[model samples]
Target chain A: MPIHYPNGRRFHETNTKKRSPAPKKISYSNRGMTLEEDLNETNRYYLEHGLAVIHKKPTPVQIVSVDYPKRSAAVIKEAYFKQASTTDFNGVYQGKYIDFEAKETKNKTSFPLSNFHDHQVVHMQKVIEQNGISFVILRFTQTEEIYLLDSRFLISYYQNMDTTRKSIRKSDIEKNGHLIKMGFHPRVDYLKIVDSVYFSN
Target chain B: MPIHYPNGRRFHETNTKKRSPAPKKISYSNRGMTLEEDLNETNRYYLEHGLAVIHKKPTPVQIVSVDYPKRSAAVIKEAYFKQASTTDFNGVYQGKYIDFEAKETKNKTSFPLSNFHDHQVVHMQKVIEQNGISFVILRFTQTEEIYLLDSRFLISYYQNMDTTRKSIRKSDIEKNGHLIKMGFHPRVDYLKIVDSVYFSN
Candidate 1:
């Protein structure tokens, strides 16, 4: 026997008598989706819930040419992706300006500093100087763990790179960063961590 | 005699002896550039002076198809411009979230409400509800005058459109909006106006 989905994909049916009585909880972290997709979904949830107004900036592209065919919409025919000058996410949250860059790594032991660009470092520093909350969300895909690392600590490491190691180890993150617990609706409920870390004072 | 520019474009030179003794002041407003270009220049000035950290979000595009030719960059062979979910300019300034949309109208008497979309109105409303600063920068290109109209007033007019007019008259803007004095360094010194209007007690 086979169970067919609405889109017509059939799954081989298993014997009911030999199966365990209890059903197992589904784990979303193993779904093989990118971290970006998860963050987008989480942002959408936050927006609908009136928790935050954050949004990911669109991908920058250098449009070189466009074709306007007769009785049709104009089409971008030739373009190249451009390097972004700012971080991906920014918005207002609880009367404070929030800006952050999200990155995921398969490497379990450390998060490479090379994941960030020099301009992004400068931008984050500027944001901090202006008293806005700036941080990076680091997702360790292997462990399904997320950490919020403040820009002050990130800048210290960036400036002293000549004397220190090139990457921030998992131990350093575990000590300085705040871990974000996974959620059912808003998969990454980062604002909860923001409240405790930034507003606790 | 003709005066030639550095790039070799000849400007018809009226007799040097007949011209005024003192050099005439250059008018930047008559430079024939778009409002977007002026705002970009102003934003650059603000960033350089550490006055603000504002940027225009990149235009959203839906990339439908791409072709990777041999030995060269990937070509975006087919794509369409997507409607932006948020306003154009957004950033943090003086610890407050700043968000705005810029528009220029050739008509000197009024600004057509049709320049805005329903979603933009909703987004601005959300920004206001969260206690963030939100507004519109309306430039009358014919008069070379700029005005900052707060979202609260704009929303009032938008909601009462059935009984009200289709556009905001210049007289109404003159009475309700803050006029931004044009300057040389930052052509539109809008943040100064923001300070006076939003932060002034």
Candidate 2:
């Protein structure tokens, strides 16, 4: 069944074992792009044009096995996470600190609250307390439609995780999130909204 | 013979591998208490107490191997770096972004510039272009003294790699950088300088 979000977009559903898309649609890596790759390229474009400065926060890895085949370079053999992180990208946009996580989901019905981690919610809350702007950029894999959801809504739902309401309906995301238009050079040009909301300059 | 840094701190000539003196020194399954561990704890304390906020930039790693134990969890099997990273930590402090690399050296005499990768210097330059503050924190393992050297100094010498003056002299860092007084709570209390420089209010 085609999953319909109240906001209007329809999400196509499928079960695949790999990170790569099955046969018909786009394969994340085959487009010669991972989410990080696209954003990094986008950030470079932004940096060059003097539009805005942003970057992917490095993935925190706890490396365990290292092989010193030579004296110069060492290779990681094993590793694990110290803990869950807050987000993937964060930086200054027009004098205000901006933080966010970018995620892609294949679920047609709803973007599962399970997609959002507990620690990430905590991180966003701390950002709010410090008066920083935090949000999540969510993309429905089937439709390739992307939306930016404010971290406030995310945090509120996160706190009520124990309550009757758990998963945020797809309709809510489409309504609350600012729809970001996809572009050619940067792919996802999100700073357009930043200028409208945070800078106003 | 012990490595002779112009700074007065002394590392033992014998490589007995003396246990770190502080009882609270970080030691979990990972590589003892990493430079990241101390900085993170420090950043958190800084945040809770209204001290300057700092965060370690995730290390940019290339994933060559990944194993899916189950559909629920993705296990990374192997990874490497496409290129070196700029530094470990960068974030906003008092309406200004703060960026820096933290390193600990057993050599009492001086820090080896080899510890820093080339791309990191380039990263700092980019951050500076955006009017961000960039720096390096050098910990003399023998003395456990933490010094914050502004990126300007590191950049000037880093650029002159073709000529002499590759590694920064300990004496130069001691004179130019702010000597951070290590404390019980924060481990490395760097926010004191941030407060003086950015947030006097």
Best by DockQ: 1
CAPRI docking class of candidate 2: incorrect
Q: CA lDDT of each candidate?
A: 0.77, 0.65
Off by over 4 Å in 1: A1-28, A162-164, B1-29, B69-71
Runs off by more than 4 Å, candidate 2 = A1-36, A70-72, A80-83, A107-110, A161-164, B1-37, B47-53, B70-77, B81-83, B106-112
**What tens-digit string does per-residue lDDT give for candidate 2 at A92-171?**
66555678888777776577677788778877777766677788888777766778888998877677776566677788
Residue pairs in steric clash, candidate 1? none
Candidate 2 RMSD computed on C-alpha atoms after optimal superposition onto the true structure: 9.0
Instruction: Return the top candidate by lDDT.
Output: 1
Per-residue lDDT tens digits for candidate 2, residues B82-134, read 45456777666655667788887766766778767878887777777766677
Candidate 1 per-residue C-alpha lDDT over B66-160 given as tens digits, one digit per residue, 9 for 90 to 100: 66566666666776766778999999898889999998887889998888888888899988887889999998888889999998888887777
Clashing pairs in 2: A58-B58, A64-A78, A65-A77, A65-A78, B5-B109, B62-B80, B86-B120
